[model samples]
Target: MSDTGTPRMKRPSLHEEIVAEVRRMIVDGELAPGEWIAEMQLCGDLGISRTPLREALKVLASEELVLLEQNRGTRVAPITFDAMLAQFEFMEALQMFAGRLAAERASEDELERLNAMHREMIRLHETGDRSAYFSLNQEVHTLIASAARNPPLFSVHEASAGKIRRARYQANLSYDRWAESLQEHGEFVAALTARDGQRAGELLSDHLRRTGIAVCSALKAFEDAGERAPDDRKGRAR
Candidate 1:
């Protein structure tokens, strides 16, 4: 309660802000996966001391976004194909359930809000604002999950979604995939509008499956190129 007797919004503490910033850095690939975290450099960049930075890192470690190795120091967790596949599979199941529930439970106002968000996402996409589009893209998924009216399902979805956000973002880097994703969302919205739970669920799941394939393909290509680079260098020397 505030002094005026109205409930006051509690602001996030510095510790919480640090955690979120670090998490964003990792998710946005500013802190690359498998790259060792330079604690001192980060502390200097963020203008914070080691104590709070370490505390923030511990929280990220718990989220499995960072690895804490004894003596080896902390590094951003690597995004492996196996892990990406598993995460997408898990998310596909969750989204399918949520899509069904959302079609059944979402109110008119909520559905309208989702439509509005979809419009904004389209605008962002057309303008080539990828970062903003990606953020709104996640928001669209979040809104659908929220509309499901199932707390336990939403909670689990959110926790898992955080882990795979980077993969989802990276999957959109392909122009074809990005455009296809928009078309999928359009169909998804139409299904929701018609209150067709089955169609909505299937569409959402298929969308995720495609996204998983794109991410896995991209990761494989990247790893293959990295491996070939050394051989190419040796050949040039010979």
Candidate 2:
């Protein structure tokens, strides 16, 4: 702890806690997409007051994780084909930019760190642990972005990440798609290791485009099957 001799903060604010919990619930399917969030029910489950919960919901809404209807309550945002495609277009461009920068600028130490992360991801993928694999995959990509040392690019990438995380999660639901993702990631790491910026950028862009197609196909199937439930809980919270 001698780097600065300062104590690290370990506690999160009430709003932060609530926000994280709610986001997890949404992303993990504890709260389904398009599901209406009953205010009293959720507050009771979390044992929190309305003030902090409302603040948290407001934050999530801004991130597009939740929809706040005027004179109505909050609901988890529904996933749609068009919305997923739109987000992926932006994400793909940013990822390509980051990949090029990372290949050009990542230090040996940084490459070692990313290689370690890539190994873990490979292990998870081989074991068919989709959830854990996806989580690590996100970290690997984030590390690449960080290694790029482009603050503005990282800022935009981080913001887009929150909105598209759920879509990315859903993209790998198909076994074939998941396997393809693992293969793509392997090549991506290889490109990074070789310091091939152009190759890395191309791989990253292709990876994102495939993910977008997967998500759109899945959403279309859901729509065709009429499996999506209508949100009926739409009134103002008491």
* Most lDDT-accurate candidate: 1
lDDT of 1 by residue, 1-238 (tens): 9889999999999999999999989876678778899999999999999999999999999989999999889999887778888998988888899999999999999899889988987897788776677777778888899999999999888778777776554443466777888889989988988899999999998888887777777666766676311111111100
RMSD to true structure for each model, in Å: 6.4, 6.2
Per residue, candidate 2 scores C-alpha lDDT tens digits across 32-72 of 78888998989999999888899999999988889998887
Report the Cα lDDT for candidate 2. 0.78
Each prediction's total of clashing residue pairs, residues at least 3 apart in sequence or on different chains, is 0, 0
Alpha carbon lDDT of each predicted model = 0.81, 0.78
TM-scores of the models, in the given order?
Answer: 0.86, 0.84
Model 2: number of clashes?
0
Q: Which residue pairs in candidate 1 collide?
A: none
In candidate 2, residue 147 scores what lDDT? Answer: 87
